[model samples]
Target chain A: MVNKSISEINNRIKDGSVNVVTAEEMVGIVAELGAQGAAREVDVVTTGTFGAMCSSGVFLNFGHAEPPIKMQKVWLNDVEAYTGVAAVDAYIGATQVSETLGMEYGGAHVIEDLIRGNTIDVHAISPGTDCYPRKILDTTLDINDLNQAIMLNPRNAYQKYNAATNSTSQKLYTYMGSLMPNYGNVTYSGAGVLSPLSNDPEYRTIGTGTRIFLGGTQGYIVGQGTQHSSKSGFGTLMLQGDLKEMDAEFVRASTFTGYGVSLYVGMGIPIPILDEKVALATAVSDADIITQVMDYGIPTRDRPVVRGVTYEELRSGSIEIKGREVTTSSLSSFKRSRQIAGILKDWISHGEFFLSQPAERLPSDTVSKPMKQTRGTAMVRDIMAKDVMTIHKNASVFDAAKMIMDVSFNHLPVVTENNILVGIITAWDISKAVAQNTFDLVENIMTRKVITATDTEQVTIAARRLEQHGVSAMPVVDEQHHVIGIITSDDISMLFARRN
Target chain B: MKIRIIINRDIVTKPILAEAIIETGIPLNIAQAHFDSTTGEIIADIEDTEYRMIKNALVSRGAEVLRLDTPINWDEEECVECGGCISVCPTKVFSMDEEWNLKVDTTKCIQCGTCIEMCPHDALSLDV
Candidate 1:
């Protein structure tokens, strides 16, 4: 029943008598001595994670211009910044893409550029008001010119996250990186044993106002992040720090091929060992933590979980998926994570860093929810044409073409006598059949692998599938694979048109 | 030493690299090789002393060989030693040293170019 307070730990740190070790090192210490023994021996356990945190941004107060214009809209280095706050204050989100430079440059790039001491071009437009008369301003400013540059991230330092793999046959570009076709590779992003929240999984030591290392400087955990779900083992932190004091080495900007830009943030937290329970929690290892490998091919919010895997299996460079071995790549940097933890431990041991009692403990029972869309919430069944005419697989190509032309439809579903969908034949397929001089059964020319929509599926998902497969329409099928209806690009466009 | 050999359309059918390896008695680790009907390109690692010998043998066989000085450029100054490139690289071009610092063995780089895209710092690029 060893008990110690943060004040006691700070006193030890001040006297240069505190025994500080990284979470990775604490694992061995706890294993050597029991948790109770280790709690008496160790004072603080440092943890770290360096990965692409897309929900990061900064609040900048560019001092008032000479003419004093109220900035209604602002662009920092061509990347848009939300400027609805004050006269010259704006919050630059990390994921905002550049208008002129496109995905090549973004808000993350602008932040990194500022941290690197590079000058940024600031352009703003304002509808002139009585008090503030200036209309437009274009200027270049460095990080030094800003009255306050604060890095206030909404979500960061995820305790654990799902590993991503593609089950589809197409190369899927996602925030998880380029997932190869047919589960060719897997990518997981987290620092496994070295993660900050993983060390304090219960949010016992990490919460509001907990002192932390943010981008190589001292920072604080503001509160739980936007999607913090500690109950599901994927807790997140909201952090705040002085951006002007941040080191460029710890802040970086990255661009995913099709997904746009993100910011890689380096974050560290020191967990003071108050008791044996705290010691045991801080000693958690890669093998102890479990996370699901999600199939990223599914674009829906609730992606199917492929399998449960331990971080030990992930960090080993490979994991088995459906009995086949797939090499694993980590988007998070473990090497840098270890360095960050080591640096935090050094700072604590040298008395440069101190632990603090959190102002409020993070909720352990929180569960995240999907965003509710206010518009475009229609289901596929609502807009799909009902009782669509179908051609039999045994029918000739000419019959399919005649059915498509007569019904004024570009695609016709080939079905069995029981109305079970077998394939789909487009007018283009019939034309290609005629050009090749081969007029045979509709099954021979029909596309065997047909993209389909379900009655219960959201229209947005069906639309995405059509666009992904490069098709203008899809057969709406049921659980029995019966062609119940058909939905086309025209039907979707018409729905939006009616809504407007 | 790493070198990229470009076999012309006429000599692509012949085993120029295999013959060069045999002539110089140096083993070649071919990291990446692409072949078509008209042209062949190979990037391989060889001993430093045998580079000139292999280049001369390859050039005699109507192949253009160039030392690979800048195929994949890793900017050390900008890199924070993140291990983002380690697992994505098929040929194991990146690894961690004793201090958990990133180490790059460019000889094994197959130029898959995934690492360049995966790097968060934009610290990696292909010169070609």
Candidate 2:
């Protein structure tokens, strides 16, 4: 039941008597001392993670142009920056590719170059207005020339994430790195027990305004990150820091083979062990934290989970999948992560850093949901043509061929006297009729077993039916078997075009 | 000393390496090898003193041999030691020490270029 406030810990740190340890060290300390004893002895536990985070970006305030142009479009070193905000203020996303260099260079590269004190080419355009009347401006500037450069990541440290493996025969190039064909390898990204969010799984001390170490400089947790799902054990953190104070060694740019560029960020957080529960939470080991291994080969919103595995198993360099042993690799840097944690621990022990109580706690029960799609709801009646060309069974083959040739139609429905669909004929069928010398009637060459589409069927289902039956068109019918209309692959494609 | 030998299609099916080993009477440790219908590549480690003898024997057998003095270059300054090369390297060239520090054993590298291609920092290269 030992309890301590952040202010008390700060006072102790100021007195040069505070005890702090890294999350990795704290695991052994807690195991030896137990949670209650550890809470009484330890003051803080620092956690860290260094991994590729694509949702990270920096916002820059480039002061103002000579004539004060409202930058509608902007590019830094040929990489585009989002100018949808205020004038002269732009956000460069990490994954945005370069117009000239493509994926070989990107916004992440520009950020890295700026951090390294390299000059960057700044290009901008504006639809000139009276208040801000500059048409185009191109200039070179470095990190020192900017008014403000802030790194505001929407999502940075994931608490834990699924491991990725490919099940397909061909190699897969993805944000997960290059997955070898036929499960040749497995790639996982996380700092495991050293991760910040994993130490504060319930977000007890990690929330809005919580101080953190961002890329070698002190930063703050802005809020719960995008897609933060603590219920499923994949919590994330949104962060903000001053890019000017960051070290180039802690921030890097990476280009995934077929995927675009992403920023590899080094981040750390100091968890104040206020109570026994907090101490126990920080004691979580790799074996205690479990995550699923997903098959990235499916390429769907819901990739199939191959199996549940612990971080200890993933870190062992190999794991069993479907009765086959597969080698595992890591995209996140554990060495760098340990270094970050150690640095933070030293800062706190020297009283150079102090933790802050969160203004608000993050949600612990939320789950990330898939995007709701509207395209699959379209019915066959919405895209089918009502004016269907039909031929009677008693009609001559020449008449059927004439109707199909005149409209450039590939298929024609053969119906009875009451206009009920009984068979279907194609231009190929007429050509066969000529080759076989059977030019008497349409029924002689028509396919009697017609694959028909109901008016109420979904457009996607109708398209699948067309593919399954190997037909170009299908006659839409009513409950009474009346040929109401026709659906073709072209019509479905046009509908897709319109929707897109 | 480690060397990589490439046997062409004309003599790929023949036992050139075994014949060379017998002729030189030098124990050769075959670390890795890959064979296709057109060609075959074999990487083996042998004693440094017998390097010339094996080279002559392999050359006499019409097999192209190259000394793997520097198969890959690691830029420690740029590398964050992400372990992205551990699984892709067929020979387990990269590993984590007990302290979780990255350790690289270039002796096991087959020069397959998989690690160089997969490195996010562009730290690993075959330029050497």
Candidate 3:
């Protein structure tokens, strides 16, 4: 039995303020009051998770200075910042490592420093210009000094992340955290009932533009996360939020020792108990949310799933794998997750927080690509460079030349101020410009008409297109036509290697 | 019949191996030796009975001994050098070199399985 419309809840929320219950309390409510009664009483169920996600990053719009350089190259406290957006605006990626400190310090650290009200060493070098004269500038910048600081993450809070274990006889260092040898210890990321997407299960309420509590402030989901998948029944989303409102405690950077850097983002999503189903989904216990155990020792796209286990068994500190008791730990801190959820619950119960209908629903049909398959065809995403290093159209010739020389990459995906794929510049293009003494601006020399491949399209099709166009690489766009990745001839050669 | 021994300054400054051989009248060969100011480690080959006799003599002389089947080998392809083995190893067997790379002292390792359990990647094992 279900009875409660979203409008009725919103109307009550508007002025007729009603009481609220937490995701944890809702568990007790349904057990006692039943789903119908619980749904009628609690307007919304607050869910949260604080986890390390490398795909997370902060976008900063630095207000133009007296003599602002295009800022072709930018670094904050020695950590490289992607200045491929607007002239002054930059994006600090969580995984982007520091030049001097290596992987020990990264963009995530810079964001944390900014949030902590600490001034960071800002360094930028640009070729001399007429309109924008400042070429070399070194200064200190705090988060408050920036015009806008927004948290726009590509992926966060994986709904059913795998539990990590090592199957090989030796120990391996991976981004999944330190896995003890021979299934010595297991580590899982999902916080079960405390996870936001786990509570939703279905994307009925939490979707695009759904307002959420992000790091102690209000934020909304912009669109689907890069690896949005449910195939097993759930909705995952990439989220965006204003950085100026977030708390420093909830937004921090962590270097995973041997692994790369990741951001510890605190997110609280409210699930409106519109019906009994929503209430039931919100009541899911740790035992209900099942995830697979994966052995990273066998390094392959098709990493073997040792077995399926639940958060309950994982949180218990040990699980049986291959008839041996292996110690279990968590990569995502559940204590932090519960703390965030408790904060959200307090806000909702106090009528300080309100739930908003999603501006747009996240597509539930987005399926994850299967790992094992007979060799025949492969998607562009399978071979494309997902972590692409891009060059802004406004970048200087010197900057472009330096980048091309540094990485020794031929093709540079030229992005506009809005991060939209405009065109590309090749080594030949740069060489030709340099030979003629015309390599001044990327926007001036970059080819505007760009040939691109969609993520889902077959690699063979992309290969044929590349051959027809006589290009070495092609940009891979998503359904939204955003340049998500780049496919190169080197990546496609693997398709041939698969034959042997 | 092959083993490695870690000796303190008291045993290190003395010709302990030669003394042990002469005392036991056991035919032994010193395969390799590494010595420093206060400590030393030596690899030697002998008969099984003689090896045990040497072990007793070394321990009696305040020397730490480790039996070895073969030298321990590192699988480089499988190792990312996380340095998990350095702490668990009691003999200071596994250490990070100047470049922070996991370096194994074959002579010092006792095959205690502590490092094997500590290593997340299965990279170290006795070659034998």
Using TM-score, give the best candidate's number: 1
lDDT at position B112, candidate 2: 75
Cα lDDT of model 1 overall?
0.89
- Tell me the deviation in Å of residue B90 in model 3: 13
Note the residue pairs that clash in candidate 3: A169-B122, A170-B121, A170-B122, A170-B123, A171-B120, A171-B121, A171-B122, A172-B120, A172-B121, A225-A238
lDDT of 2 by residue, A360-381 (tens): 9988998999888864688999
Real interface contacts reproduced by model 2, as a fraction: 0.77
Ranking by TM-score: 1, 2, 3
Expressed as tens digits, the lDDT of each residue in B1-128 for candidate 2 is: 78989999999879988999899898889888899998899888888898999999999999999988887788998788888888888788899888777799987776778887788888889955
A1-500 per-residue lDDT for model 3 (tens digits): 66677677767766747666667777888888887888777778888887677888888887876787888888889988888886888888988998998976788888878887889888888885887788888888788889999989988877778878898666656676667577766767766877888888778887888888887788888878886877655456788888877876677676665677878788888888888888888887888888899988765576899999988897665689999877665656565677778887777666677777887877778787766766567778777888776789899978888888987878888887667887788888888899999959988899888888888787877897788678889888766657788899888897779766
Best by DockQ: 2
Give candidate 3 regions above 4 Å deviation: A11-17, A370-500, B1-128
TM-score of chain A of each: 0.94, 0.79, 0.73
- What is the iRMSD of the candidate numbered 2? 0.9
Worst 10 residues of 2 chain A by lDDT: A370-379
